[model samples]
Target: MAQLDISSSAISIPTLLIVNRYFDEVTSNIRERPMPWEGYQRASLITEQELLLLRNYSSRTGLKDQPTAEKYIDLFLILINKLSRMDALQYILVAFDDTIQKFPDTLVYLCQLEVKSEGSPFNTLKRCLGKDDDYLNLKAAKIITDLLNHASPKFVQTFDFTDLLLWLNRQLQSENPNVVDVSVQILQGLLKLRSFRPVFYGKAHLMNIFMGLIQASREGNPQMLYQLLFCLWLLSFEPIISDSLDKQYGVISQLVAIAKGASKEKLTRIVMATLKNLLVTAPGDNLAAMVAVKLLNFCDNLATRKWTDEDILDDIEFIRQELTERFQKLSTWDEYVSEVESGHLSWTPSHQSDAFWKMHASQLAADRGRLLNCLAHALNVPNQDPTVLAVAAHDIGQFVKYYPLGKKMVQDSGAKQKIMELLTHPNADVKYRALVALQVLMSHAWDQ
Candidate 1:
């Protein structure tokens, strides 16, 4: 894979500058096309002085005073509120985009001025998001991003981003690469606000967006991958969100895959960092899940690499150390529980260990044959793995041999019936395992 040089700053840029430089280069350069009739009509709304203000690409410091900057904002808002044509509206938004990027102080001025109408600056931007045009929505989203980046906490709390958030979520699935990139960028920026984190996290489409970005990472766009991972990294800081990152979503597996083949240092850094946070913030079940997915091996592999970044090295060592300590603490029964809960059965060493069955088989019967029931459920699942069926049957048979009430438990749990049905399994190993378990179930304890 070809490697890309990703700036460390790209992942952790300051909030005030997030929408300024990092995003503008990729987001603002929409393709040039001929102006529509509405473009000409909207152009007429701009007075010569206002047009001059739009043309001037100078810094905010170059403006004479505060009132001049306010006048400039007033003109931009007037044009934005009045423009209905997509082409003309996009052009005005583009100019405002340049204004915000070049002159951030304009945000402060615009924030202070409130027009008395439905078409206020914030409302106008929100309305623009409802348009069908991706580029138009992108510009509107960028303007919103800049405002949010610099907006006061009071402003943030008072404003409703419900619809805008929904629009951004929909944009994540856009065909335009720029649209997807900016959507993630805006989302990442939005999530930085501590109060806004839960709002975005609470969205019904949150997990779908995550899965989509994870799938997109496989396409090998480093920047897109980094932005998506950065959002996950941010989400990991909140324990609630971190705990809910279920193993079933294949999130940990996908991230491990990314770490294994990541060509950029920044990419490796963020992936490991995210996994490390998830390990600590999530519960023991999640920890067991990490081990279940072989994250430990990936950590060991990362530990051997000659990493130039100390943070990456520290993160790798921390994950390896934590995984090792946690794995070491897992008792045989706990290991067995983790395996059973993972819904995948195999002939791990515990399955063949005579001592394991002697020590833990009675425990399986303790919780009303809960573990045995899980094993049976695994057996009963449609089109289950042959190996899983074989091992599940073997475990149930071992349970019956070691525990006095194990036969009754298995019979009651329907495990014996499933095992009997599996005696005719297509796979030789499965049929054989099921036969052995069936014989054990049918025989008396005195016979042994």
Candidate 2:
């Protein structure tokens, strides 16, 4: 690995300047290159030639008192940023990884140099539908990717990656799928910052990023696709952005495809939760389509599984209830009954209150236990009748909704699962009543 003393100031400018003049003709013409939409390309990355230049620059930077130490560090990084080959970049990173830490100012200039390179009309990353081979853009993107991978959050932010964010937006529009995928990856990293996220969200250009992520989700590799979904999750945190993104892309179908193809390997829960957020913000018609595709079953199946993670279970439960409620609206009473028999009915409407069960306030606090015991006894009588179970489910649903006390009682007792299990009863009415009970429980849980 190559090492440079960033604090040193003793260097032969005349000797290095002579070497640079010799290599300028043989290697990259890295002077003050302009950025695209911002100028022209000036650097070339011939690896062998760059190695020689990097070595010469590294050696001369050793003089501790040399005031020009910062300048040497700055120039070497500029040349590194312009490197077009991954192998060349990997070499630079390995060689100077430790040395770069001593100079934040050099990191800042490296970023500036990347921007300038992209602005060159010959820039590789700036393309749309019709395109030349995206050499410069692709190379620049790879450098950015590597830099982000190895950089500290402080380093990246200190250099103000917001301009890099803007540059990435342009790359995402490129016709070359490779460029778009890499661009999404960079944006995904940038969104980790609360500060940087709003910069993207503050403007209309966010829509472009939204669409780009969705497109990449479909076409990108597994890692890229996962990052894309995670990025979508972050974007979904804003109600307005998620709503607008849904209006533009209606990504439910894409999300569904991803879920279906997930192979139960990784990201299934995150993908499902993101789908829930999208469902919450989605238009009515879009939500109805979600129901038509049986989204509730998707989550219910996952939520009921013993191995699901706690957060994932909670996420699935939330989506299950939300999707079920919408499904209930779309389903007929008979259809809901069918769902019960098939163990597919997941939602119920609000429970109806029975006048006889409504307690007086003063006695309510004192006799709550007595009232719950009486209800539990009535519901727990097995094989008595399906009608009894149905009534029990309905009554409990109403009691839980109107009185907060009922939730603790039901949770402490076996009533919660028993009520849920009734959805599988042979009699459709019994199953329907169980659905009513579960809906109330779900609503209460949601409130908690």
Candidate 3:
């Protein structure tokens, strides 16, 4: 086994004294055991007296004043090193509780030691396993795993593990591209241990925390955005100990909102990647489709003339494909259209005759103007496709004639300017259709 030279390490003088004494006790116990395979076999056996002495030493050293305690810790470590050689399996198991209970602070110090020693503790533990007779190595592995699972509240409060994670997240948000890259590498290491996951996931506000991180990346930190997006993707896909409804809702909703409002190109790309991940991993149900549709709507709204022609075509095609896939399983056009249009499932269709529209006439009036503009655009398509023109004219005429408030809304809406513009279009068919929609509005206005 590779031995660590704690003699020259930063371990305090008092700790060294305790460790050396414990080592002497363990060495003596090995000598008294029955002979087996020369030196190695002798080192493998531990006696009851040695176990009691080690436990007493552990308790006393733990109770010593800080200065004395530091010196005693060094001694305890010496014993651990000697025991590592002897394969003192039962004694090591018995000693663990005392070591853990009596010297809680030691774990923190050891973690720092491990970090400074370039994973020396892990290496030593691994080597101890090489002697197949070393039950101590197996016990140590279990203890370490337990420590990770049972990370105490006091330990967390005193340490910066959580803060370190947050700091890394902040660094990722830095404008410096290199900082973001380094931050991601650091995060990868931190997340590798199973013990750390509960802490990461236990934050009741984790969803909000991640959302804030993503929002900060919208300016110029695309790399940070990507990292945050990937983190969220992992969290959503990772197997959690228990399903949490609130967390699921919070994470998905915040992600959808971010995808909709994010403006940076890289951030948008990351959001799209996250959305694709969700679509693939999430169940094929109404809730999932609703989220997918919301993202699609946001994408549709952001798809502008400023985008390259190819981009526009691609955007449209993507939306079309998703909608087609989502609607294909539905049994009816109305159900499918409702879902596509609003991204919500309608468990039951309304039987009332648009009564809500009548009750909120003024509110609907404001929206009615935009609907008319959409109607005008559909009617004025250059080709004047007969089917489209008929649908546009029919819907517009019906709305105007059936609803008394519709004519009043149009007159008050300042849609007259848009109507005039449409009337002067170059295509006679388009011009004629615009005139017809206007005449319908006018006839309704006169009746009113």
Residue-by-residue lDDT tens digits, candidate 2, 1-448: 0112211211111111111232233223222221121011223334454445454554545524223444454444554546444344433433332333344344344445555663321122222112233433333443444444334444444444444656666677767665565556556555544445556766567566665566656554566677678777766655666655544554665676787777543567667767766766554434644543466777766665674456666677777787676566653433423222222123343123244335321222244555444345556665636755675566667667767766777777667878877778899988888898788888888898
Estimate every model's Cα lDDT from 0 to 1. 0.72, 0.52, 0.46
Candidate 2 segments exceeding 4 Å error: 1-72, 76-166, 173-178, 194-220, 276-293, 305-311, 321-448
Better TM-score candidate (2, 3): 2
lDDT of 3 at 225: 66
lDDT of model 3 at position 7 = 22
- Model 2 lDDT vs. the true structure? 0.52
Prediction-by-prediction clash tally: 0, 13, 12
Q: Pick the candidate with the highest lDDT.
A: 1
**Candidate ranking (TM-score, best to worst):** 1, 2, 3
RMSD of 2: 17.5
Off by over 4 Å in 1: 1-67, 112-120, 154-159, 219-223, 342-347, 365-397, 404-448
lDDT (10s digit) by residue, model 3, range 1-448: 1112222212111111111233335444643444222343345434444444444454444345444443444444444555543544344443443454455665555555555764344344444433444233333443443333233434323433443444544454556544444444444333434335455666546545556666666567655666666555444433451134223343444555665665655455544544443544443432344432455556566565353334334544465467557656654333423332222222222212245324432332344465555445544445544544443443454456556767665555444445557566666654665587688788876786
TM-score of each: 0.77, 0.42, 0.33
lDDT of 1 at 151: 63
